[model samples]
Target: MADPFTSALVRHVLGRLASEAIEEYGLLRGLKNDLSALENTFKLIQGVLHDAEMKQTKDKRVEEWLKTLKSASLEVENVLDEAKTVAMIKSLAGEMGNKYKRRAFFSYHMNPLMVRFRIAHKVKNMRKKLEVIDANRSRFQLTSNTTSEDSAGIASEISNRETSSLMPKICGRDEEKEKIVDEICNQEIGIGHDGDDVRVYAKWGMGGTGKTTLAQYVYNHEKVKTHFELEFWVYVSAVFDIRRIIKSICGLVDKQLDKMSTDYLLKQLKNKLKGKKYFIVMDDVWIENEHMEKWGELCKALSCGENGSTVGAPLWL
Candidate 1:
């Protein structure tokens, strides 16, 4: 039988491939054809995932096939993740090259040519494995009857989890929580050169860490509550839709901003945040290479806040 996490992993990989950053990566590295081939292969596999799950109980061959597909899909996910991380690191290093000469060695080690070649080779191999698995499905008479709505249902159920400002009962994290709270509460408000600048404090680590939990404790602390006039908790998830994020920020203050366009929303947000001390928690943010401009735009919109305004982003690194 297929592992329960297999379906979720497959969905995540598909989502990653569909992301703008990956599309840009493909274009830049001349891997557009390879990426497209992988995408098509995954879609074929996805259509039969449900059918295979149901048939595995009745047929041992189907069970083994699911296992093989699951293993190959996981390897693909790992390679994609590694390539993305390397690409992001290299981009950052390039941006800071003038100031950080020490990053030269890192850049040399992560040569774009080498990275592209490695990713291309792995993608070709993974595609071969996936094609073999997809070809076998025909022998088993697997039909592509799984509707998109079915997949949507599963994805929605998995993505429905959210973050909140309500304090949670916890243990062994008081020290960390106190430190973060102090950082937020003690920043001089309207008193220095960078006083009005929105300071960002991010808890960067792997997923499943206590980052969000700690942020919650700090967000709801008595000090935090009194320091800022408005506080918002936004669950950004994987996709960074600027309009949605602005709508969320405005929605928290009982103002319903229209979703017609991002420009209109940002204008309204600027007015709403003007001269107020606000704290926003952008929880579960997964930023890629393409999100920098969007992030900068959001920050510009938030710049209307008064001194001591801050953003806490607990990134799923």
Candidate 2:
């Protein structure tokens, strides 16, 4: 009953729906992997804390092990954030309804699906490693003391007290925070500087380098907050979804995502951002080349402010 154009549109929409389902599956798998990793890490930390000799190490091995656990936990949090980004992308892809060119849709959506799957696989392997560490720590705890109840009770009490204290205050990277904030303040400012080109500041570090925390601090600083008329924060993890990013920005500005074409949404973004100095932070950036290029397209959409207008783009990887 439909015309050729309408039938093609329906096929396109169905294809996009299939892609969204795939993305959701991948994201759910990634979340499972992350949750498993967190559980193993928690068990490992608990086992380590229960060891009597852990507190008596001369090489500070226990401290180093605790630090590794903290880093692993942060990585799990980052993985969860990535899963959320993938879900948002999937949702936007379904809503966009084949608006993007076929090539753009495939490039932006299908390619990142591979990245998410690969990362999920890696997280699963890491989870196995954490489980092994947990087992070893548990064995050490069991064999360390088997004959003395009084001594065991005292050791257990001491371990429990120490863990209670240390659990609340996980180790963090202070120097990294200082350096990142300095770079963002110095390189990501556009309005006050006498430069013609927009300032683009990028922080490309490893996964657990505290990029998100560093950016959060810089984004909330008094000086940084006062410099830009409008500020936008976007989480562009491995799954690079432009429509979702736009929708998120709209939500932040208290706008809805319905009843807008890609072009219309972009226009609204430009109008909202035109002639006003803006600070944009893209956090937890993808490390892959393809994902990075896809993110560039999102940036291009947001960088269309009027000529002579100032825009600060700070990307933290």
Candidate 3:
């Protein structure tokens, strides 16, 4: 009897709390314990949401409990959103130090200490509300949903799955596929100059949402085939191994290129790509901030293509 919508919301909030972006931003430094407690309590509540949904009509108290849980979950989501915003501002302030001195001056509210102080207060208050919710769980005598398991497994499976240009026929995505295909073939949308960077268009969403499938359709479309001189597809798994990735791209061009050293492959890749329009699908890319340098390295190689070269990838965020 669990509401599918509610379950999805809870799952999204949990993903946010456990995201690497949160850790990278250093949000909730002193209140890590509080955040963990909140996570655990949410899981427990999620387990019994089905039972509560089943009994809410007959028991007013269970209905109230569900209301409280829903409200708290939304509040937590808002708080985390605010944290992400402040952290992004802080990061921008650091990077633009003297370049945008006037803009950076107004970012006092993004000061890490001040930001943490404000968020910590909200988190502590939220924790108290969750405690009350947890206490009410036992009174209802609800049991965990048997189908509820760790979402990590789902994330892992998604990360491990490789995609290709061969996608089975699907529905409800023809309009979307046409739009992206238009962008790829439209000369006005991307740079056609020799020195311009490769145009990258990303399709992002939750796992199994047909992002890859849509990309597959676009890649194989007749217009796409007619528009580019070279095409490649590389599956970038969770570990952003630049050498492995370069090797894959090289192998796609010529299998013997796969055995070369990283530097040699990159040099050859640049040579082979010179003066030719190209289209590449880098599927399942999970590039984090730490991989910026390596990403740049790959871009350098891909940038050697003729005008209108493009790369597409599926993004999670």
Clashing pairs in 3: none
TM-score of 1: 0.63
lDDT string, candidate 3, 1-317, tens digits: 54444554565576556555567656776778988878777666766666777888888888888878888889998988787777777777678776664655455665556678889999888888888888888998987563345422333323324567897887885677899999988766753224447788888776567778888888888999999998888777555666667766666444565566777777877988888998888876654554566777778888888878898878655
Question: Deviation in angstroms for 185 in model 3?
Answer: 0.7
- For every model in order, what is the number of clashing pairs? 0, 0, 0
Write down the lDDT of every candidate, Cα atoms only. Answer: 0.73, 0.49, 0.72
Could you give the C-alpha RMSD of every candidate to the true structure, in order shown? Answer: 7.9, 17.4, 8.2
TM-score of each: 0.63, 0.40, 0.50
lDDT of 3 at 142: 85
lDDT of 1 by residue, 79-111 (tens): 887777776776787788755546454465566
Instruction: Encode model 2's per-residue lDDT on 1-317: one tens digit a residue.
Output: 11122212222222222223334545555455454444434432433343433352543554454455445545545554566666667667777776643444467444566656656775676577556555555433333322234232222322222111011222477676556556555544433322234456666565445445566666776776675667677654334556656765666332455556667777776677767666677654444333545445444555655433333233323
Candidate 1: list runs displaced more than 4 Å. Answer: 1-15, 26-74, 77-158, 189-196, 252-259
Candidate that beats the other on TM-score, 2 or 3, i.e. the better one: 3
Higher-TM-score candidate among 1 and 2? Answer: 1
What order do you get sorting by TM-score, best first? 1, 3, 2
